[model samples]
Target: MTDSTRPTALVTGSAGFIGMHVCERLLADGYRVVGIDSMSDYYDVALKEARHARLARSNGFTAEVGRIEEPERLMRLFEANTPDLVVHLAAQAGVRYSIENPRSYVEANLQGTFELLEAARAHPPEHMLLASTSSAYGASTEMPYRETMKADTQMSFYAATKKATEAMAHSYAHLYGLPISMFRFFTVYGPWGRPDMALFKFTRAILTGEPIDIYNHGEMSRDFTYIDDLVEGIRRLADAVPERPEGGVVPEGDSLSPVAPFRVVNIGNGAPVPLMEFVRAVEAATGREAEKRYLDMQPGDVPATWADTSLLNALTGYAPTTPVEEGVGRFVDWYRGYYAV
Candidate 1:
């Protein structure tokens, strides 16, 4: 594959903040990227090694720090980049660290999404994106949240290992036809984020004056979705591929998969903000003043989340609508210029 090398796209979690903005928008859309990551001290492994040292200085970006539950290192990274398209977004994300390490969410969200759906069921990747959330609508008192919503009650062991890796990627996209697309992200924040979420821990405890915890007393509500509008609605949903629904009769705010080529959209910002106006946009983006400390909503939390991105704008014509006070003032100016404090 070398007509001056530019046809790859394997991004598993490229030192992740939405997989480093979806491998910097697939290297600004020219593609050549292989990224796969495992720098998981769970957080700030030196900001995931400075976002894999700025995408390994982009000689068409190549990276590989293992662990997709090691199906021989994701089948040796799908036999060394035979990738046409596969963006699994490496798992084990948090929800109170899956109620205190429930086997690190059953070995990274159910055996690492069943070893990236068995390396896209032995290399059949033309379009396979799978990062799901909105806490898989557990305990649903639904208001907004759609993508065929009926995600049985998954209150948490990290949303039941992301709803058991969306029912093991809809039985490997209905027994290996494989064209999956399970996105469901919601409270995605911004600017190299994730030191355990809540707007990067309430903007690093409201710029270090320290206290912030809040929780249920702040009374949740999220659907935030920003990281450049969730990597531009996941690069327009890596091209909307999910067909198999021609009747199994499952409608009413849908969760699509009558039998799979799999589908589940909702990239959210379909409005839901209040957690005290998202800590008043990180206390007005770091002018400071948090010290909150409320608590008591633990044990797999859930107070609210909203997203009905109309089947991700009817399958990616586009829609993630960011604006949490300009995405919390671009994560408070990249957390005061990357922790210079």
Candidate 2:
């Protein structure tokens, strides 16, 4: 039974990198957390289990193992927890992987989001925050992508599915009056980060004397947001729930939907760091130079991504403040300690 005195939050993908950090923050803030994760073998199940084990240390957390897309899975959890907050982070990640296995994206990103929306509709939460990606901005030459800008052109199936979820969520928010906030995350990296991410891969390769692959011939850049900063942004945004503006008059630069209590906010450092500079930061953190294998850009990849966080500041009075070098250093330290490398 959930404590009537404490707010309950249902976090999907609670064993994932961002999900674990978010769950920890919620637990610290006195919210009883109900977590559901499929514990997919996408990367390493041990890493996911480790994250879940850490969260289990808190009595406030209750873990359930199953895919969100599973029939009655999210619905049952919503009914049981009656969550005041919903943070949907589970998805088929990786741009290149989407090309190899597109069906997983359809099942996890599309069908899974559909199931979540249906569950939310049946049992409304105070706020439903779903993770989007800067990749949804897709091939936009715009230096700093804003939520108000057009984002119809997605370069990857992964991004396409994510963008589709935004639309799917918007309709549900409008029709069902569910307050929803979609987060457009930049390149998020930090301690307990996914092994598939560049920071982890590069750090591991550099420490192990293996060459790190430099895509786009080292001419790319990303707004690398630290995990803690991203989680803080999410925590604040949970309180800054969007309400459907009366008379459908949204303020300038606001991405709040005219007909729904829905909005899209970008959580990023708002600073794009060059790819090679990031590699240098890894070298600085690990005290070892990387043998770089420069390669052509992979399909479904953008050369650069920058974020406009003005809306995030306006709404939550917060913006991500971590530098890439420092964030990468933290990840490298964690990697060394975790892998004993």
Candidate 3:
């Protein structure tokens, strides 16, 4: 039953790392949340199930298990929920995985997004937020990537698909006057993160007395945004809906479309930390030194990613700034408790 007093948010990929956190935050804010996740075996299904279990404890949360790419799946969900807000976080993630299975990216990231757009077209939401990636600024060596910059050189198929979705969403926003905000997240880490992600992998290897691979020969850097900080940015951005600029005049450093109620915002810690320092943070948190095996850079990977979050600040009055050490420590605590290590 729909709660007339509270707004409903339909969040796809709700059992995933970021999706789970976003659903919790929305529910905490007194919104009825409808969460959907396919529970694909990209990582540990047990972990994803645990996340869903936590969300299920909340009475305001409703969970649906299914793939978004299925025909009429999203349309049925939209028609049933009539959600006022939509957060499209479901997609085939991982750069190396995309290299191994390009078709998954096509089906989930591209085709899945198409379905979401179609559903939103049929039943318009008050606002829609789509997840993009820092990889979308692929092959662009420009430090502190601004949203207004051209993102034409996607080095990886994963990045290319994400960039394509931005275009797809923009067209929908322009044609249907749908308010859309695309958030380009940096390297996000914290408790309950995906096992494939660096923080979780490193923590597990370190605790189990195994060597951790340091790609790019420990030369790479990343704007490591904490999960809480990233979630806070998304929560604030939900209310800071973009509008089409008047007379095609967008403010300086803004990525707002002049022809549509849409914009791309970078949600990242403005500071890029070295990979070695991040490993050290993990070591500190776990109280164990990692046997670092430095190696050459992997294909379809950038040496570094930095975000220029001034536009995000201007719009939402907030930006992710969590220090790596503190965030890593929090993750380590959760890992030890959860894994009984």
- Compared with the true structure, all predictions reach lDDT values of 0.81, 0.94, 0.94
> What would the per-residue lDDT of candidate 2 be over residues 81-117, giving only the tens digit for each residue?
8999999999999999999999999999999999999
Query: Model 2, 316: alpha-carbon shift in Å?
Result: 1.1
User: 221 in model 3: Cα distance from truth in Å?
Assistant: 0.3
Q: What is the lDDT of residue 291 in candidate 1?
A: 80
| Model 3 ranges off by over 4 Å | none
User: Quick one: ranking by lDDT, best first?
Assistant: 3, 2, 1
In order of appearance, the predictions have TM-scores of: 0.36, 0.99, 0.99
Question: 14 in model 2: Cα distance from truth in Å?
Answer: 0.4
TM-score of the candidate numbered 3? 0.99
RMSD of 2: 1.1
Worst 10 residues of 1 by lDDT: 247-256
